[model samples]
Target: MSPNPAPRPSASDTPPRRRSVQCAGPHGLHRMSYLEWGDADNPDVLVCVHGLTRNGRDFDELARAMAPHYRVVCPDVVGRGLSSWLPVKTDYQLPTYVADMITLIARLDVDSVHWVGTSMGGLIGMLIASIPDNPIRRLVLNDVGPVVTAASLARIGQYVGMAPVFPHFEAAEAYIRAVSAPFGHLSDAQWRQLTESSVKAVDGGWAMRYDPGIGEPFRQTPLLEDVSLWPIYDAIGCPTLLVRGAESDLLTRETADEMGRRGPRARLVEVPGVGHAPTLMDAGQIAPVRDFLLAAGAAGGGR
Candidate 1:
């Protein structure tokens, strides 16, 4: 399915604010940069984690929309966006991400948090929230589940794990759009924002925000024919919401259906024109999220 052209934002538009926190990493210390919106003192903390190659900025629109209700924290996973790169590329696995999140949560000093994750981020959230004494009160898994498709995994492995340098931002944007077309319809302006957010100015050209070596571990992981994460999903005790792009290749329809039927009985919301993931950047996307968060909060009553 072809992506719809993303709406254009005016020149006067202001991007989201960013802040950094030093977190303990395998290599001693690392700075994790994140985009923060809403009241810092608001105890209602909502942590939004982005996809593999994507950054925290992906949640800019969603954060702004959710700020009125909760303090939205969107972190740039290590080795991605403005976050510090990992010294050991092998440390780019889920355990490292969970550890970083734990440090971030400790810094927040919040008793519990509401989580929203896309793709790889969703997997991280699932792993963490499934722990025996996890602090996540509610979770929203965006286009990701325990059972991932090999075809989608292969497609992601083809590009995400690689480092691509472009002579100009336009070229980089075009490349991202081409590869991410599976993400459904997005406006030209949205595509532009995505391209701008993902690339950094190098000596003469632009390079991806993450370390090129990340692909090393990603490539080495073997693909499973039939992935089942039932135990992990079953262990989650909090209210859960699952959002999937209707045309997503990564989160198969069958997996999404099974997710709803299984542990926690995740409520599923399918975005009509998206695939692989939903970027919660528009009203249509944000509504379900806001509704879910409110419902989760009401149901749990301050867990």
Candidate 2:
């Protein structure tokens, strides 16, 4: 008898569609790349955005798990991933990011979407969700909040635009492992996935896939104290869920507590032993998010 043929991958296991849409910025129009998974006609949409210096691929596992229930769309957010770089570096701020998302949503032809944003991505979600009649119906602020500590800002500033070129792929992986230690104990395969998607082959060596100029606007501003956006947080009316690394320095326990008490009054979940942020790769980390987003009547009130 002939050997059994290789099994075909399941729908959720299949790769997502690589798509792009043009977005207007301060200088001109720029291309934003995104990954789409699940039923193209499914109107139940989930928009997952990555943190600063990261890309849409960060949500690969989460998207796969969620694709069965919702149409998952993860964007590279302007300067990162396969997206175009802005000619004006200062345009890398939240306003430009929010506008780009709006354009992406229009292209998707969706009336509303559920948002899962990590760090900088979370801030963008907060801004978009705060708008009157905005498209975001449910929000997941992963390991971030309206209040960000100055120390964490300093830590992130140290390397946002370093633009280092590695001699080999291993070197690039090592660098990612070092900086992303707070991602909390990922396996070798997981680490490889993160590194491969984060770097690109250049003339001399491998380099990060983002524009170095993306850091210009951030470095120009001095962070003297904790960055607080209570007004923005207060403006949001949709259901919000807040996930924090238990030992995170960026989003303190105190701030997360207050976040539960006010506007949108997000329900909080903490991943033990992690710091800075949770990668949401493993089953444990993905459960709360999946549950919250898939739960019935999540729009009425947070769980």
Q: Lowest summed-lDDT stretch of 10 residues in model 2?
A: 1-10
**Model 2 misplacement above 4 A:** 1-10, 299-303
- Candidate 2 residue lDDT tens string, 233-261: 99998889999999998999999999999
- The RMSD of every model to the true structure, in order and in angstroms, is 6.1, 5.9
Decoy 2 TM-score against native: 0.95
lDDT of 1 by residue, 1-303 (tens): 001111223311435567888888777889999887776666777899999889998998887777766677899999999899888888888888999999888888887788999999999999988898787888999999988888887777788756567889888888888888877788899999888888889988999888877777758885857566879988887788899999988888888888888788888999998887888878999899888777623436222
C-alpha lDDT (0 to 100) for residue 56 of candidate 2? 98
CA deviation > 4 Å runs, candidate 1: 1-17, 296-303
Positional deviation of residue 97's Cα in model 1 after best superposition, in angstroms = 0.2
